[model samples]
Target: MARLVRLVRRYFILGSGLHLVACGGGDSTEPPPPVTVTITPASATVNAGETQSFTATVTHATNPAVTWSATGGTITGAGATITFAAPLEGGPYQVTARSVADPARSATATVTVRAIAVTVSPAAVTIGAGGTQEFTATVSNSTSASVTWSATGGTIAGTGTTITYTAPATGGSYTVRAASTVDPSKSGSASATVTPVAVVVAPASRAAFRGEPVSVSATVTGAAVTGVNWTASCGTIAGAGTTVTWTAPQSPGNCTVTARSVLDPAVASVSMMTVRPAFLVTSLGDANDGVCSWTHCSLREALTAANADPGTDTISLVVPAPVGAAVANTIVLTTSLPAITTPVHIVGPGADVLAIDADATAGSPRRIFEFDGAFAGSLAGLTLTGG
Candidate 1:
């Protein structure tokens, strides 16, 4: 009975040991996580010729490095981070990052590129003052090819790419600008020069003495080329450009001075000038002679010559000293002077020094002067006695 009890205890201990072994409670093992790649900024939009950066996150990967690529444009850099450069062409492009550890597990990012450009046709132009010009704008690499137009000077009319520019009444330099409707920053410009079409000459009418010099000037409005061409109908023009000297001719007549625009020959202005004749009386003798020489002219001779000349005439007296010391400074008229038929102005020395005496004791008493026909004349600085 004692031996059987000991054997039963031994069998129970062996059974517990076998049951623990069968449970299998040693160190445990688990499967590694699957390799995956994810990219930041899955989608983006940028302008052409621009740059963008992308980073890739690789999970459960033995090597975190990645190779960069793109469907279009250039891609640079290495590792998880890379730079993408967009091309000049406008379109949608793709950027991809493949894990070096697992090429099958890669990430892709969409990059849309846009190229915008603007241009102006007939970039430079010149127009007359108060004139209008048409301009057009062209846009590229855009679905909406419309543009906005503006001018630095003058009035702008119409809308869209095509518009009209009306120059101001005054002339100057100006600019016309065209900007894209989608992108205002991208724009183009054109140069404009507004010129004057009219030429104006100052002093529309004037009266001048023969052989006199007159100053004439012209104003040219809104012209890129300034100044004018001076011309005279009966006088000589001196100098050039906007201002000139006009010397009246010796003959007395009506003259016209013209200033023509250098830019437009058809545009011109004219000024009317009246020329009058003048005479000088060097002798105080009362001889009723009709001839008056240039060097020695008597008062009576000056009067006769003035009546025959056209237009208004002027006579100035300058008496010579008598040969005898007792001779007086006087014109002793024997007969009436010639009748004045035209308008004439007679100017003498001082009234206190010179005198016209009509007292005739031998023949019939005569008057110092006579006027015939309807005319206007003047006598100044002369004493009349004994008519």
Candidate 2:
């Protein structure tokens, strides 16, 4: 029996040894812990006014919580996210993820932020007094942004790109500025100027007759003139249209007229006219009775005698006189005509010569009257009157 037991034991030992060989049971070999690294998204590229963020994560981390930092960008909430305040700025950044098992074992990551830019159209604008002007500003990159526009000591009309502003009370210079919530550092500015326009009027040099109508005109010059104002010196007429009629007073005399532009009250013009007196003739002296004759003596001889006669020196010219009447007669005098004074001697009579007088007619022939006389100022003789 002892011998049999021994044989069994030996078999068992040999089987165990074979089993161990087949299992290959030694501790399994594993790749060294993978080199820990942190994963982080680069800082977001934002437009001048838009907001952006940067985040970090652990590549193969046991814990997701990580510490983040931006050299220039702003970090928020547990240092895992970074915000670009103004626009993305250039700079080196890093993030780290640490394991609880081995605080010493940590992973790190790198991030970069890009910059944003903007543009504006019609950098400047001009407006008239009591007027308004409009312009636009454009953001080149980014969306979902906030902006602040300030007219430094000036009035801001609207928000965002399209804006309208009222001109200052007077004419002068103004400044404007723009800022974005996302990018405080990114800002822009522009300038505007305003000016005033003028109007003018011109008048004629001469005035018209009592019944005549004159023209008065005005002109507007400068930025933008819409309407004009007209005025007259005397007669009644329409104020509208380029011209206004002017009438002279019944009394002949000097008159002045003026026209002015409404836009510019300062500019204006003027005109003048003069009136004269008029007259008519009524009666004249006779030639017969020793006064004057037209028989042998020509009309010139009769005029010479009348003009040389001292008593009638100041007498005025008149139409129609008796052929054989006394010297006394009435006549009409011209307003501007001068007085005549001279002495004359009558020689012809019935014995030696004959004499006759007659009234001058409107259609009297010119050669019918002839005169040769000396007198002070102008003289109208009987023959000259065609009598």
What value does the lDDT take at residue 219 in candidate 2?
Answer: 53
- TM-scores for all candidates: the values are 0.45, 0.43
Question: Lowest-scoring 10 consecutive residues by lDDT in candidate 2?
Answer: 276-285
Best candidate per lDDT, number? 1
Instruction: Quote the positional error of residue 283 for candidate 2 in Å.
Output: 24
TM-score of structure candidate 2? 0.43
Q: How many residue pairs clash in each candidate?
A: 5, 12
Model 1, backbone clash pairs (residues 3+ apart or across chains), number: 5
In the order shown, the candidates' Cα RMSDs to the true structure are 10.9, 14.8
lDDT per residue as tens, model 2, 184-216: 566566676766544434454654433344566
How well is each residue in 146-185 modelled by candidate 1, as lDDT tens digits?
Answer: 8988888888999988998887656678999998876677
Q: Once superposed on the true structure, which residue ranges of model 1 sit more than 4 Å away at CA?
A: 1-35, 44-48, 60-65, 88-92, 99-104, 112-186, 190-195, 203-209, 212-217, 223-245, 252-256, 260-268, 272-387
**Model 1, 14: alpha-carbon shift in Å?**
19
Relative to the unseen true structure, what is the Cα RMSD of model 1? 10.9
